[model samples]
Each structure stands twice: as C-alpha cells, then as structure tokens.
Target: MLAWPAWLTILLLVTNLLSLAALFFVTRRMLKLRRQKKRAFAFSDYPVRKAKLEEIAPCFAMSGYGPSPDSEVRFIGGEGVVSSLSDRESWVMAALAKGVKRVFEFGTCSGKTTHVLALNAAPDSEIFTLTLHPDDLAATEFGFGDDREHRDIALSESSFETFYYNGRSSERHIRQIFSDSKSYNEAPLRGSVDLVFVDGAHTRSYVENDTRKALNMLADEGVILWHDYKPGVPGVFAFLNELSRTLPLVHIADTDLVMYRRVRKQLSPA
Candidate 1:
C-alpha cells in the first residue's frame, strides 16, 4: 500500500474516528431494545383480579363506547404499589368486566398491564395499546410469544413521538400514525373514542397534556384513566383541576389512580 502524506493521514484518522462514533451510536440503540428492566410489578405477589366474565359485560353496554368486551390490565409502578394493584388497575378492570364497549391505553410498559386487559376483553371487543417501542420491534421485543394472540392489543406507537416530541423515535423512520390527530389529519377521530388511559408520562405538564389530548378523543359518554396520582407528582393534582367538580370521577379504588367519565351533564351540575 502507498503511504499517505502526514496531513492526509491525519485527516483519514479523523474520518475513521467519526465512523466509529456513528457505529457505536447505532449499536447502543439496538442494545436498548434488548435491555430488560429489573423492576417487578409492584404487586407481583398479589392476586390477579378475578372478576367472572359474566360480571363484565354490562359496563360496556351502558357506556355506549363501542363493542368493548370484558377486559383487565396489569401495571407496574412504584414498589408495593400494584401489590393489590389498588384501583388504578383494579377499578378499570371492574368496569371492563362490567362490559365497557372498548379499551384504550397509553404507555405500553413491559406489556404486562395491557396484556391483563386484553386477555379478558369480550371476543367482539377490542383492546388498543399505545407503546413507546416502534411498530417494527413491537412484535419482536414486546410480543410475548403465543400468549399474545388473544390480547388483540392493536398497537399504536406513533403518538409517543408526536404528542411527546419523540423526534428520534422509529415512528419517524417507519411513518406510522400514533395519534388520531395524525390519522385524521389534525382532527379527532370521527364520532367519539370510548375509553382512554394515559400513563406514558409522569411529569405534571406531560401528564396534563396527555389528559387534554385524551379528552378530545373520547366519546361524550366515554371515560379516561390517569395513572400516577400519588403525592409528590405535580401534574397529577394540577391536571385534575382542569376537570369540572361536578363530573363523575372516582379516586383509585384502593390506590392513588383517578378516573373521569365524559358525561357533559356531570361536567358542572349546580
């Protein structure tokens, strides 16, 4: 091989170093996808909700959300939190078991909680889960093998980026639609969305914004679930303020979660 001049050789070395840096960046992302967290379901040892299928059908019928069947979901938050999953996870399932017409969730962390909900949904009902993982790796990383078939979690990872400014996310690369505003061209879904659960962000502004976005999507008769309503989270309490006092809402049955129904009459009853 011919030897290069001193200055030219230095330039070549710099180029090589830059290329290495780029390669490392790509590799780090791949590793993140495979990385598994040590966090356990706060209620790992607690009993799973066991509402009989018969009990869940009626909630959906009354809600008029759509064709929601019986369903439940499991979530992992701070330690000992899910021990019984408190109301954040349970109350919704109880409602789902009551036969809510549809199920919608944000933040598909580890696929456990959403999976719980999907398993119980009525055969005709559907469960939709929004996750941070992209559409491509969703099947490979989040898919828990044969167990996934029944859950029917229509995955939507797009919203995580747009609504959250997930600029570097794979959603941009793959061109997927994550939010209804995107799908409907900056318009909300036609008609109304049945139920919405937003748990993706924990910060006050983030959670508050998500709540507003969900509100616009739900059917007038729909309900929305907000996670991380415990003490210390600024946004939880602030977001709650946006709701009218007369709206029908319940604090987490036994936990710090919160829920609201979309009844306009309840928005402000004198």
Candidate 2:
C-alpha cells in the first residue's frame, strides 16, 4: 500500500491533470464559437434583398407552353470542371445572354461560363473575357485587406492555359484578354456591353475595381451579374453587401449570383 503522503500527491496530480484536460476542451470550444461569431458578423447575408428569377428579368418568366427559347442553353456538365457554375446559375446567365450584342466577363476560369454566354448570345455578339495568365500570377495586385484564402484560390484557378472554349466554334465569339483585371483598360469598351459577369478574384479590391470598370462599360440597359455571394466567401459577401447600399443589387433566389441593371449611366469611380 502507498504511504499517506504519496496517496495525497497522486490524488493532487490526477486532479490537476483532469482539470487541465477540461480546461483545454473548454478553451477549444470557446475558440470555435468565437470564430463562428466573427464569421457571422463579417459575412452575414442580411444586406442584399433576395429575388426570384422572374422578378429580376422578364425572360425568366415561364411561357404558357413551356420554357421559353431564350431559356434554352447549351450546357456542359460540371464533371471534371473546376469552379463551374451551378446548373441553375448557368441557365440564368445564358438566358440573360440571349440576343445580347456584347458581353464582358471578368475571370474566365475554365471559360465555361464564357462559352455558355457565347452559345446563347446572338451569332454576331462578342464576348470579352479577361483572366490572369498562370505565368503572370506575379502581377496580381492583392490589397492588404484582401482575403488570403480567396487570393490563393484565385491563383489556383488561374492555372488553365487552355480553356473549355479553346477549340470550339464559340472560340470565334470570345476575345480572351490575358491580364490581371486591375491593369486591363475598359476605355475602348465603355458604354457598349450589354451584359457583364464579374467573377474575378474574390478580393474586395479586385471586385471594386472590376465593378467600376463594368459600370463604365455597361450599355444603358445592360445587366451585371456577380457570382459567389454566400457567406462562405467573405470577400464577395461583404463587398456586395456594402455595394447594395448604393446599387440595386438582387440576390437570385437559391443561387449565389447577384444581379444589377443600370437605371442610368453612372460614372466610374476614379
């Protein structure tokens, strides 16, 4: 049997260890809750009003017979495609592209959306798609406040040198601009684009920059769509929430896309 002192020592040590383990678990759980709270505070979706597809555009309204021809789009599955749009989102965009004369897209990741835009647009329509070349990631100008996670994702997604539309006939309609969107000039295309898709780097600075340029280039009746508006993507979620204050941004119901139609020409922020 152990001596009284030894028994006391063992009891104290065991008690200390159990207390430490409990404290460790409590600390871990507290940290997790704190992180969740911070995320909720930073990335919540209460700012933008959500709307059904028909509310955003008349083309999404159902015809008495069936889906309108404008809603019929040539679609490729997301299988083996990285960062592809959801089927519903693609349909919304393609339907919007129908009959549009000029479309501008920021961030041509895989060019899947660009191809869809071309397929649904008028045969003579031009699709201008911009993306950073994999070789030129060094040129990315990420701001200090940019979300680090998405900056990495932006670089990773830029790995495509050849896109989905590379050899297809849609290639004829797409003008691929290989440059960081921050450095690309929108002057030549100003007030001419009927549709604009802003899917570039999810960094706040990049979104702001591309949006300013999109506004400058938007035709009077043009539409702009921004992807990844959910809370999981902090950069897009927060930026668009703030943008909703000044612009009439609509979150498409059940999708991560936000839509805006210009009521009047707005000057780009200098």
Candidate 3:
C-alpha cells in the first residue's frame, strides 16, 4: 500500500487529540456528580431527631421530658450571617445551654454562636472559645496528621479578626483563647466543661484532635456538638461517620449538627 499523505496524517492526529480532550472533560463531570451524590448520602446514615421548635424549648416539658427549673434559656441571633447558626439551630442550642454551666467552642468565627450560648446559659455560666487571630496566621501550627484537603480548609477558615460579641454584654462571659488548636493544651479544661462545640478546622486531623480533647475536657454528663457535617464538607462528614458507628450520636433533622451525650453510669446494686 502507498504511504498516507502528510495532510491526512496531520488531520488524524488532531482528531485523536480532540477526542481525548472531550473524554477528559466528560470524565471529570461524572466524577463531580458522584461526589455530590456521596455527600448527600452521608447525612442519611444516622438517625434524625425531629421535634417542633416549641417542643424542644427548655420550658415546654411533659411527664418525662422537661428541662430542670434551674435551666434558664434565651435565644439571640438570625441576622442572615453566613457563618452563624441558623434560627432553628440557634434555638436548639439555646435550649441546651439552659442546662449547661461551662461551654467550650472550638471555633469562634464571628462569635455569633458564642453570644447565643452566653445569652441562654445560666446567669453565672462561663464560656471558653478557641480561634486564631487574623494576625497569627504566620505563626499558626496545624496538625501534621490531617489529610491535605482538610488541612487546606482549616487554613482557609482560620481567620477571626472581627467578632459579633466583641463589645456585647455576652463578651463578659466569654474567655477567648487565641491559638492554633493543635498546640493548645487541654489540661486546664479537662473533665470540667458541660458543653463543647467542635466547629474549628474542617480537616480530619483537626477534627480528631478537637474531639479527643473535647471528650477529655467533658464533665461526666456533658454534651458535644459538631457543625458542618452536611454535604460538601468531606472531612467533617467522613470523620463523624466513622465516629458515630461506636459512639452514640444523633443528627438533628433539617440541620447539619450532630450531638453526643456522655451519660453517667449508674452504680451497681448495693
């Protein structure tokens, strides 16, 4: 057979390149769709506790379900802030705060949640929130064990220069700890906190570290809440998924919050 013409050979090469480019784009699109579906599926893995807003308030109680009288609660928030808690979540947290005496927050993005906690907690309650100042980014030290994706997210969300509670009355109740959570010691907080909110870094390593310390810092009957466990947050979702298997966790329906309660064990029969 005669050799192919130079023009034909050049055209065939270009066609192959175009075909490969199209295949690459199509494959990428499919992978993205798969990831979206996977994230949606993650929220369905745990049980959701559904209740009317009023039903969950600290004051509305029946025979077996009512907050203790000492538990005082008040909710404050809903200014359309992207980083703040949703109205329903704020209410749930406020009701829970009625029973909390010492609260710890892993991240204090704008201090909106912290303000809400202080507003609802007992009059003499105290709050400790950990976060990095915008100025400390250069000096911050993150965990080495975190996955690359998680570490990147944690770094991106670490800045906290302005806060809602900066001059508010609630500020009096809050003790802000400015430091990278990885290097922060848990010794002073161990076994004394009544509520811990893990909303700091979205990385797996940071989540694991914060969770371990939260458990250690928790009082015998304390509660822990983690945020951003919904779709698109892979690190938070993945870690909580593995954790929920062995720990008692309940997802609050229509929200991205998961709660774990440490129940006090009863003494053996006398």
Candidate 4:
C-alpha cells in the first residue's frame, strides 16, 4: 500500500544499518590483526632446537638412572589441581632438583612444584619460591600490551594464600616469599642460584622481566627452565622464540618446557 518513494526510503535505511554492522565487525577484525602484527614485529620466531630428555642432563639417561634413587621423586597427581604440569614434566624437574643445592622459582601456583623440588633436593638444599600474595593482587602491574587473557589467568592463579607445602616436612627447606615478582629484590641472590624456574605471569612483559632476573640469579653452571612454551601461549612462545636467537635454548620434546643451561668456561693453562 506504500508509495514507491517511501518503500525505497525504507530499503535505504535498512541497507545503511546493515552496512554499519558489517563495517563494525570488519574494523574489529582488522584491529585484532594489527595487534597480532605488532606482537609479531616485536618478537620474531627463531628456530629453537627440540632436544631429547637425556640430551639435557645425564640424570635423564636410562643408563644413568634405571630405577635408582637419583631419579626417584615424590609426586602428586594433577587431579583437581589448577594448571598442573604433566607427569613427565614433573618427573624431569624432580630429577633435576636432586642435584641442585639452591633453587629459585618465579611462581608457586599451589606449591605443588615447590614441594616436589624440596622432596628431591639434597637435605640441606634451600628453595625460594615466590608468588603474589592473594591480598596484594591490587599491586600487580600488568603492561598495556600484555595479553589480557593471561593477565586474568595470572590473577586467578595468585588466589592461593596457603600452598600445598604448608605443614609438610619439606616446608622446612622451602622459603615462600609473598610479593609481586616485579617488586621482588633479586640483588642479594644474584649469581647464587643453582636452578631457576620461570613460571610466573605468562604475559610478555612479566616473562621478560622474570627471565632477566632469573639470568641474574643463576650461578655458574646453573640451569633455567621456562614453562608454557607452546604457540597457544602467545606471550611465552613469542618471547622465547625471540630469545632463542641469542641463547642456547632447547625445547624439550613432548613437553611445554624450554631449558637453558649456563656452562662455566674452563680457564686455559698458561
């Protein structure tokens, strides 16, 4: 019943709204691509060698520890635990802990890893594990360019005030530090840690900051292990891929851990 002019006007209005909706979605997608491009530009992929377990340390060799005490470790299953490491990864870390005297951990999600480290370390060994205090979440300083999803994950993981090691015999060897890693002082412990585990916030800025401090804390011949190296973790994957260009980093096959060992140079005889 409407005039042709009025019908044409209605069609024009509907077309205009649909065009705007399409433009909005397109703009959103373009912005996402721009952010990803910026991240790629900031951190380029460098080939990281995938290494077998035995290649990283002799303790992992079948000949070296065929059901021996050196490779034995106390372990808790990943059941009901948040962000737990795979069984194989846990065993690898535990075996490595057996030979180290001083261990530094960047993040203690539930103190499960900390407990395992203490249980395997030498009786006199000291373990320092740092995590954000649940009460101090407000003090976290996430960078503007950090992955928003991981920022939320970091906060969620910091919700633990008490950890699995609380009241266990291994707690005697463990020193739990409640402080944001960015504000934690590493000067006193520089060049003294035998092992460093970098598993803090997965955001790029936090990972970079923690890695810098981990390197500073490493002793001669110390080893540094970083968790969550898969491509899904954009911050960790990109940063580590970029880091592999300058450091001898090896991604352990079948696991998400990347490792770097600092070997002392032997002095030449005169």
Candidate 5:
C-alpha cells in the first residue's frame, strides 16, 4: 500500500467524524418526535356542555347543562380490564348515558365503555358495538384510502373474543357485531342514535369513515365522543386537528377524549 499524506489522512478523519455527528443528530430527532406531545386544542368552541357535579359531593346536581332529571345515571366501578376510562372520562360517560335509549360504539376492544354505557343508560337502552373478529382478519383489506400502519395496529388489537361486559347484566343491552366496521350498515340507524362512541381504528382513513357514519346515525342534539386524540398518534392527531378547523371539536383538558355535538339544522322558511 502507498503511504498517504498526513494532511489527506487528517481531512478523511474529519469528514468521517462530521458524518457520524450528522447521523447522531438525525437519530436523536427521530426519537424526540416519537416522544413529543402535540398541543391540546381548546374545549369551549365546540357545541358541548359541561356536566355539573357538586364540588363537595360526588353526586351530580341539576344545572342548565346537566343531564335530564329523568336520566338514570349509574356507575359500575372500573375493575379488571385491559383498558378502561379514567375517572373523569367515566363521569362524562355516566352523565351522558342518562336518559339515552340508543348508543353506538365503533370499537368494543375490552367492552369497558360498553359496560359504562349500559350501566348508566336507561333500563330500555340498547347498545350496538362493532368490532373485528379474529376469524375475519384474513378477509380484512387495506386499500389506498386506508393507512396500512394504523390498520395493522387495529387488527392486532382487535383479537379479543371475550369482553369485560360478557356474562354481566349489561350484556343483555349490548349487541356485539363481529365484522369489519367499514362494511357495517349504518342506513337503518340514520338519525336515530342518541350517543356515539368512536374509539375504533386510530388511522386517518378509519377515523374519517367512522365519523361520517356517526354523523349519519346521530339524531338531533346527539353527542359523539372520540378516544386517543393525543399528539404522537399521528393518524388520530392529524385527522382531528384538520377536522376541528371545519367542525366544532372540543378536546377535554388532560384526557384523550374529544367531544362533538350534533346540532339539528332548521329548514329554511317556505
């Protein structure tokens, strides 16, 4: 081998060092993105009303914005479950369940929310939840309109055959449908649902599809709640951020829940 000039050797070493530094910065940036928290949106602009609970007591009190007087609000404690709502989120669900007769849920993961809905809703209330069955996973397809990563994650998380509500009293009120949410028929339920919980796929495409169906199925003055509206969840964060600009989407402070109320549009005067 030929001897290299000392100057040339030093130049090569410096170039290699610079290259390593660049790589280090890029890697750090990627990891930082993974941990970064997105800014939370405001909660006042949406058509949502807060439920009033007496500061001294845990009981809900009558307020202009509180649940109707006839609503039967109940709480089944959050015990063993894969995933469940926070106390704050539970309060919101229980308060809204009062007097509601029809509820629709997009994802039934562990059925924790379904149990909450059934426990608080009226005795005659009916809940319909849609989730993918493990057997149907082979048939599920991801198209150009869907986010492959989100879809895959959803599939992996949808493998539960048993739910928290199974064998419980609330099971009588829940009608679990084992199928892909995209193919579920929302036509018959149009304008009939009192509350809709959209906790399904976190992908942008799935969120869009579920939101469209929820809007169609909601009755006048109905409410819709979405889960996992955090920043690092790219699909959910991006879709919700853009949708909030067009629609009044309120993010509750400190929780991943976002609320949207459907206001009935009055027809133009004849």
Candidate 6:
C-alpha cells in the first residue's frame, strides 16, 4: 500500500515499455546470428589450381572441410569436420559465390586474394581490388634469366603479372583485374563496390578505418565480410556491435569466417 501520483504511474508504464522493446531487439539479433539455417559453401570439389587442390586434401583429412570465407567451414562427410581453406582462397570464393559482380577488397598480403578474384569472375565482370604494395617495389624472383643487374626490373614486372594468376587458368573463365595503386581509404572506387571484404590491418584503428571506407563504398546489394573473427578476437566484434542506430547488419559466424550482410536497405531520398 503506497501512495503514487497519476502522472508517475504513466511514466513507469512508458519506462517498462521501452525496456521491453530493447530486450526484444537484442534477443532477435542474437537468434539471427546463432539460429540461422541457410548456409553456403558446405562442400565443393571444383578448384582453381592444382596446387590448391593438393593442399586441401592433406589439410582436411580429418575434418573434410577447409576454412571458408563465410559461415563455419564444411567437410565432405563422415565426421570429416574438414579443415579451413587458406584464408586467402576462402575470401575469393565467398565473393564470387555471393553473386557479386564487382568486388572491393583491402589488404593484399602477398597479393593472394587479389589473385583469387582474378580466378573466379564471370567472362566480362570487372574486379577492382586494391593493395598497398607498390608496382615498382623491389622483390625477389627465381628462375629469371641470369642477369643480376636487370633482375630487379624483371622481378617487378613479373610480380605484377603473378598478382593476377586467376585469369590464366586454362579450365575456368576469369576476368582481368589488376591491383590498384591506391590507398584503401582514398581509392577512387566510391559507391561502386558490389562486395567489400576487409582482412587487412587487424588492429583496432586500422580495422575501423577500413570498415568506415568500405561502408561508404559498399553497393546496395553488397555484402561485407570481416576476416579472422575467432571467438577470442577483440576489435572486430566491437566494430560490428557498435552504432546499432545505423548500420543495420546481420552477422554470420563460423570457425574462421564472420560475415555481415545488409539484408534490408536504409530508405533515404534519392
């Protein structure tokens, strides 16, 4: 038996209503990531290179799957559990399978993923990937003509060509995409990317910078996948979870891959 004012009673009701709404939202999202049933890339024998196939066989002997770009990796069968694909390969395949015609990526460590994009594009699709490695930078080359003084020039040119190995395969059809000599934040590909995947600079500051830039450039149908989101990683989870007011997102998590796709578009005046 306590005395309460009429206005105070209304205020309490409003507060409780707000609390319920917040709880509903959080629970809904948690279920979306955890209880999802539609997953891609469970098993496939198709491959880009002979070397890649050989590597996969030995690695996934127990698990039957490899680290993939999105979702938990899949194994062939029989508790195969499979192994993870080399992170670089997983990134490329995920982009292709997502029906992305144009892919924008950050970090070109050894230019592996860039090369992979060059491997999986439709006949005429354009792949615009970027990396910080300078085209004229000095690098080591083996099996070149034995001219020590001229070796540097040959190596630099060869490196450029090798970065696009995906287009050279005889069995598959790939598009020609060269590595752009631009910074990730200042690249010219604004508002024109179909898919954006960020695996470069795992540090918090660098990761945030890449993400901000990627968001601006991501296209209407584009999906953004963040590489290396293990159960224990720090900065990545923060970026995905912050700013719920904007950045409507759905996260898909597995052992090695974590993806956030824009399921619904933000309605703004065109």
Tens digit of per-residue lDDT, candidate 3, span 1-270 = 998899998999999999999999999999999999998775445434434333433353543555444334576655576466887678667778774689999989878889889888778889999997777777655556556776665666666677778888988899999988878899888999999999988877778889999999999988898987764676687788788888877776667788888989899999
RMSD of each: 20.7, 7.7, 9.6, 9.6, 9.7, 18.8
**What ordering of candidates by lDDT runs from best to worst?**
2, 4, 3, 5, 1, 6
lDDT: worst 10-residue window of model 4: 62-71
Sort order, TM-score high to low = 4, 2, 3, 5, 6, 1
**Model 2 TM:** 0.79
The 10-residue segment of model 2 with minimum total lDDT is: 70-79
- lDDT, model 4, position 118: 95
Model 4 over residues 174-264: C-alpha lDDT tens digits?
9999999999999999999999999999999999999999999999999999999987888899999899999999998888899999989
- lDDT by residue (tens digit), candidate 1, 1-270: 977689998999999999999999999987776553322443332222323323333533433664344333332344342212444455455454334455666665443445445444444555555554444433322222212321223233222333322342212212233432212231334335576777754544445455666776777767777765554444454456445354445554355556665665455565
Give the per-residue Cα lDDT of candidate 3 at 161.
Answer: 73
lDDT of 5 at 27: 99
| Model 1 C-alpha RMSD to native | 20.7
What would the per-residue lDDT of candidate 2 be over residues 1-270, giving only the tens digit for each residue? Answer: 955798888999999999999999999999999999998875553579989877887777767886555567677756456887888888889888988999999999889889989998999999999999999999999998898899999999998888989989999999999999999999999999999999999988899999999999999889999999987888888989899999899999889999999887578999
lDDT of 5 by residue, 51-142 (tens): 23432123444569774354445666654555467766776777777768999999898888888899888799999999988888876655
Q: How big is the positional error of residue 18 in model 3, measured in Å on the Cα after superposition?
A: 41
Q: After superposition, how far is residue 173 of candidate 3 from its true place, in Å?
A: 0.7
Clashes (backbone N, CA, C under 3 Å), per candidate, total 25, 0, 0, 0, 0, 12
**Per-residue error at 52 for model 4, in Å?**
0.5
Off by over 4 Å in 2: 1-45, 63-70, 78-80, 264-270
lDDT of 6 by residue, 109-141 (tens): 444454455445444555555443445343222
Instruction: Tell me how far the alpha carbon of residue 32 in candidate 6 is from the true structure, in angstroms, after superposition.
Output: 31
- Model 6 lDDT, residue 241, Cα: 49
